[model samples]
Target: MRTLAVTTMDPRHRVLCRIRIEGAEEAEKICLLMGSEVAPRRQFIAAGATELDEARIDI
Candidate 1:
């Protein structure tokens, strides 16, 4: 498993959320579980703590 970061643009919450994940697949899985609309690239950016709507695996 690789370490990944995820960022979210929650307009409803009016804030950006960040999280560290294990891998691309795992990130996607977690997004689905959370009902978050995220892209592979966004996961990577999020993991890197970069500003993005979505991303992929950083590791």
Candidate 2:
């Protein structure tokens, strides 16, 4: 499998949630599950700078 990502950020560009997936659909689903909107469609070419929304209880 490959990696895709979805994220949410506050107006200040602070990370709210970041998650991994195999494709775009999963990314959106993750954001929904977290009650957030997906960040600008992004590239997850590598796990360079991703962090899960710290406010989330799942992590």
Candidate 3:
């Protein structure tokens, strides 16, 4: 029998380094790069704060 150690981290403190989407092989690289760019932004928006269309993104 083997035992594995597990660590849990709070989502609020999570460092979004990489994002991988299943079945999106070609898009994975693009997604990872985009995530890195987007994660550092201080949106000041909480979860469930706004609907999809209500969200504002500064381009």
Candidate 1 or 3, higher TM-score? 1
Per-residue lDDT tens digits of candidate 2, residues 1-59? Answer: 32233322334434655554556686764445344444432333223246655576442
How far off is residue 57 in model 3, in Å?
24
* Model 2, residue pairs in steric clash: 16-53, 17-53
Report the C-alpha lDDT of model 1 over 1-59, residue by residue, as the tens digit: 42233233444434444655546666565555454555755665567575543554343
TM-score of each: 0.21, 0.21, 0.19
Error of 2 at 30 (Å): 1.0
CA lDDT, candidate 3, residue 56 = 54
lDDT of each: 0.51, 0.45, 0.44
Clashes of 1: 15
Clashing pairs in 3: none
Clashes of 3: 0
